[model samples]
Each structure stands twice: as structure tokens, then as C-alpha cells.
Target: MKKLIYLLFFSFLTSCSSFSEYSKETKKGFDEEDRTMVSNEAANLKTITFGDFKFATSQKEFRKLNKQKPQFKEILFYAKTTDVPYEYYVLHNPKEVIKNESFTYKDTIIGNSRFVIAVSKNAPRQDSEFIKKMVLSLR
Candidate 1:
């Protein structure tokens, strides 16, 4: 009876440890692809300041539009109506509004729903020249 109890306890302990290890691995995998900032290579960056939130650099301001662009293709944001200082917000497709994890950034606060139009992350990051141009075009 004593040996049987010991075996059961050991088995339970091993199982708990294995479960934790598996959880850790899964979390790591999620973060590997989970990004919240666009890469520094997207093209067509146009700088239009809105309110107190000033995105000075075209590249820096891109983040204001798309939190984390995984590639050159489109990104999306649900913004407030008062967010953008220009008419570009009218260009967003109502259907393309993606699921933002309940985030309200400076851009969104102004009322512009954000979205990208480039190709998806199908090409190399270095070759994502499209993104780079967006960053550089903003004057």
C-alpha cells in the first residue's frame, strides 16, 4: 500500500511539471509572431499632424497608423471620427476594420479607422521596399 501511494504522488508531480513546460513553450511561440509595431520599411508615409499627438517622422508616425505591421500588405485599426486631420480616413473600407484588442491610440482617438494596402508579408523583410517608401514619403 505504501509503494502504491508513492508511485501515484510521483506520477502526479511529473504530470504537473510537464504541463507547465508545455504552457511555457506555447507562450513563447505566440510572442514570436505576435508583434505590435510595424517594421521600418513600409513606403508611402504621409505626415499629417492631428491634435497633441504628433508623429513627427514619417517612419515614426507610421506606427500611429498601424501599431505593428507584420509585412507590406494592409493593416487595420478602428479609430474615432476625430482622429485624423485630413480626409484620408474616408478611404478606409468599413468591412476591413480588424479586431483591435480594445486599443485607443492617438490616431484612433481622432476618428480615423486605419488600414494598410500593401502586399502581405510574403516577401523578404529587406525587399519590403513598399513599406520603406511609405515611411519616407511623409513630408
Candidate 2:
């Protein structure tokens, strides 16, 4: 009788531990799915706009359109005299920009305006088409 009870107890403990592991795995799956959904939604956004300010709007125009000062980090700047043809600035918010395989956001200033470009980091580095499109989109 004692041996039977011990066997039953061991079986119950094993089942409980298995169930705990299963629950953990199920929760992990759900979390991954949630992240994927959020990523997809972010990817679907084709335009970048902050309040009334939009990509390709001149700095002066931007100031007039937005009442509040916008926050961003400057990544690069190029002078008009340079071979680049346009005086540009690159800016980004490290917190909002995704550095992963999903996407990356870059703000490029050309002439007197700033342009926002989002590209998949996983894309081929040699692909100039995306850059051309972004530059052409600037007014």
C-alpha cells in the first residue's frame, strides 16, 4: 500500500512539473506572437509625420507648422558645397528606430528640407533604388 502511494505521488509531481513547463512555453509563444503583430503594424506605416510636420518640409516651414519643438538626434550633416550636391542632415530617435531585421528609420535633410526613410536592415546594402526614391520624394 505504501509503495503504491509513493508511485502515485511521484506520478502526480511529474505531471505537475510537465504542466508548469507547458504553461511557460505557451505563454512564451503568445508573447512572441504579440511582438510579431506589433512589428507588422509598424512596418505598414508608409509615411513619417510628426504632428503637422512631415518629411520633405523645410526647417522653417516645420517650425511654422508645429507649435512644439520636436526632439531628435542628429546622425550626420553634409554641406551644400560638398560633392553630395545637397546640404543634408541625418537624424533619428534611437528609442523609436528599430535596429533589427524588421526595419530602420532614417531622417535625411536635403536642401532646406528633411526626408524620412524607413528601410529593412536586412535588405541588400548595394540597393541604391531605395535611396534614390527617398531623395526624389523630397521637394
Candidate 3:
């Protein structure tokens, strides 16, 4: 919780981002692996009801990854809110998330953990901005 807060706050310090080249990195997949169908999970996890931001549920179509160490990894959760033209992966690590604006949205923040969001090259700014807030505010 503390780490997530820090990351959200940390994103505001940068004046400009250099990771624009890798902006599309999240949209590509490994050729070595077979393509998996994208799905949504609206029934599995009990969602704490929010106002109008009833984002999509966690579906199997989404992929999740994390470290195996208990001390190294605290709590990790993966979800995406499709409120915009792209998908912003809301990854929550109880410990740390690697802070990299290059691999993330401008308004979005990263800590010492793995955070990935899927968005099209022509996604809208409003959609991208809202997704970040939804992820960070999710409790």
C-alpha cells in the first residue's frame, strides 16, 4: 500500500519521458508462444463496489506474472480498466514496482515491481488518464 502510493506520487516528478520508443511494447507478444484468447473475469474476484468506475473483472484472457519469494514479493494483483481506447494493466505489488515512465503512461506511475498496460498506438488521452487513477485508487 505504501509502495503503491509512492509510485503514484513519483510519476509527477518527470518533466519529459524518453521511453516513447517502447510505447508499443505492451501490445506485442512472444512469437515462441501460441496466441491465447483474451477473456474477462467478472465473477471470480469479489469487487468492492465503487461509484461509476465499475471496470471489467479479471478474466483468464489476461496474463499475470510475479516473483516466487515470500519476502521479495508482497501482494501482486493484475487487472485492466477498458475505459479508453487501450488497456492499462493495473499491477499492484505490496513491496516495489520498477519506476519507469518509458514503459508506462505519463500520468501513470511505476514503483519497484512489474507493471504493464495494453493500449493502442492511437489511444485517447482521457482514457489513459482515467485508467491510471482507477488502478491506483483500487483498494
How do the candidates rank by lDDT, highest first?
3, 2, 1
TM per prediction? 0.19, 0.22, 0.28
Q: How close is candidate 2 to the true structure, as a TM-score?
A: 0.22
Alpha-carbon lDDT of model 2: 0.30
Candidate 2: where are CA atoms >4 Å away?
A: 1-101, 128-139
Model 1 residue 33 CA deviation in Å: 33
Give candidates' CA RMSD values in order. Answer: 17.9, 21.9, 16.8
**Candidate 1's residue-wise lDDT over 1-139, tens digit each?**
9999999999886443101111111110111334222222122223221222222122233455545432221322111112322111111223344433332112221123343333223333432342223322312
Candidate 2, position 43, lDDT: 16
The CA lDDT at 67 in model 3 is 23
lDDT of 3: 0.31
Candidate with best TM-score: 3
Tens digit per residue, CA lDDT, model 2, 1-139:
9999999999885443101111111111112223211001111211211121122223333344343333233222111111222222233222343343444555554444343444444444433234424332212
